[model samples]
Target: MRFPFFKQERRVEERPRDFRVISPRIIDILTHLKVQAEKLKRTYHRLLARDKELFEACVRAEQELDRDRATIYANEIAQLRKMSRTILKSQISLEKVIL
Candidate 1:
């Protein structure tokens, strides 16, 4: 004797796979990507503003003949520039994904 639980049954119907079913997920992913891109843009702009401020301070220090202070400010500006480059690259990549 065979058990009923041991028998395999085939599905009588299968739902059609179409764009309507997948559009929502695609939209959600694009929205997330856009948000991330905006964040990166904001961060990049903020870095630029800060870098400008540091550059001014460094110039002031140099005019005052303060080598150490100017050096420190210059180093910070360099680091900010590096961060900005990284953020810009990420933003570009996100834009490509969204497209």
Candidate 2:
């Protein structure tokens, strides 16, 4: 449909697409991730040590028939395992960031 009162205009030029460089922000994010990864690693190691002690204590509790104590240690071990998995995931993400 054409309107008698409207004018038809033609574009004479095309605008180029704008490109942006974001290396600095990326570097800052990677640096922060590196620090977080290190902290996660430290936490992982500490958890492992604590888990080992918990296992040993659980074993002693079992031998003594201390059901409640054994159950408590078992729960802690499960929590430690869950935390370890998160640390591993963070490490993998850190590797991806480096690449």
Candidate 1 residue-wise lDDT, 13-78, digit = tens: 977777565677788887888888999999999999999999999999999999999999999999
Q: Which 10-residue window in model 1 sums to the lowest lDDT?
A: 14-23
Clashes of 2: 0
Models, CA RMSD each: 6.3, 6.2
lDDT string for model 2 (17-95, tens) is: 5546557888798788888878888888998899899999999999999999999999999999999888889888887
Alpha-carbon lDDT, every model: 0.92, 0.87
Among all windows of 10 consecutive residues in model 2, the one with the lowest summed lDDT is 14-23
Candidate 2 backbone collisions, by pair:
none
Q: How many backbone clashes does candidate 1 have?
A: 0
CA lDDT for candidate 2: 0.87
**Reference-based lDDT, residue 72, model 2:** 96
